[model samples]
Target: MLEYLTSLNDHNLPYPDTIHPIVVHFVIAMVLFGFIWDVLGYFTGKTQLFEVGWWNMFVATIAMFVAIIFGQFEAGLAQPYSVAKSVLNLHTLVGWSLSGIITAITAWRYVIRSRNPQKLPIYYLGAGLILTLIVGVQVYLGDKLVWVYGLHTVPVVEALKDGLLR
Candidate 1:
């Protein structure tokens, strides 16, 4: 088991491709969609939209944790170069923070729903907007890690192996 775990591919991953991004994308979509649904529900007075938004937030809260777990595991295997290290560290911090934020937001949403399922408060909508912006920032940081830093890309891994990148 240890031997198999130690044997990593050219991307410095045990598996073929990164799983963190895949899981994280789901979390991002759910969060963004949830905010949109809540806003629409608030404006149009459609309670069903609130239901949809609640479910999305609920699932997003759960998925965020899963994404964090996979992200931590993949990051441990990333072997990021010096330039990528700072961005990776920031991404890690934000990811963990987002998980907490999402969970808290979901809990707040639950309380709101329990009190009034038909109408969402304006303050909650404001919080949703804030959460969406934070998610956008997180997405940008994540994109930087992959596009600019190329932490787990084939060429980057090869360069690291050849001692080209410090």
Candidate 2:
């Protein structure tokens, strides 16, 4: 068990590729699309769009936890260097925070949906906007981890193995 656990691919992941990014992308898309749907529903007065938004947020809230689980596992395998550490830490923090925020927002949406279902309050829209902004910041931090720091990439892994990154 320990031996198998210690063995990892060139990308430093036990799996073939990074699952975190794959799952996180879905969460990101759903959250953004859900917010868009809500905005459209609010403007167009199409209650059906609210249903779309509600389902999206519901799934996104669940998927966020899955993404966070994979993220934590992958981060454990990342072996980030000095500069990448802070960014990785920030990303981890934000990811965890998002899970809670998304869950709370979804719950709030559920109450609104249950009570009226036909109308969305202005504050909910504002909350969606705020969530979108936070998601944007998280995306930037994640991008920095991958693009700038090159965490878990082939070259970075090779460099680490060669004792080139300290």
Output the number of the lDDT-best candidate. 2
> Which digits, one per residue and each the tens of the lDDT, describe model 1 over residues 22-84?
999999999999999999988888889999999999999999999999899999988888999
lDDT of each: 0.93, 0.95
What does candidate 2's lDDT look like per residue over 40-133, in tens digits? 9999999999999999999999999999999998998889999899999999999999999999999999999999999999999999999999
Q: Which residue pairs in model 1 clash with each other?
A: none
Give the least accurate 10-residue stretch of model 2, judged by summed lDDT. Answer: 1-10
Instruction: Give the poorly placed runs of model 1, Cα more than 4 Å off.
Output: 1-3
Provide the clashing-pair count of each candidate structure: 0, 0
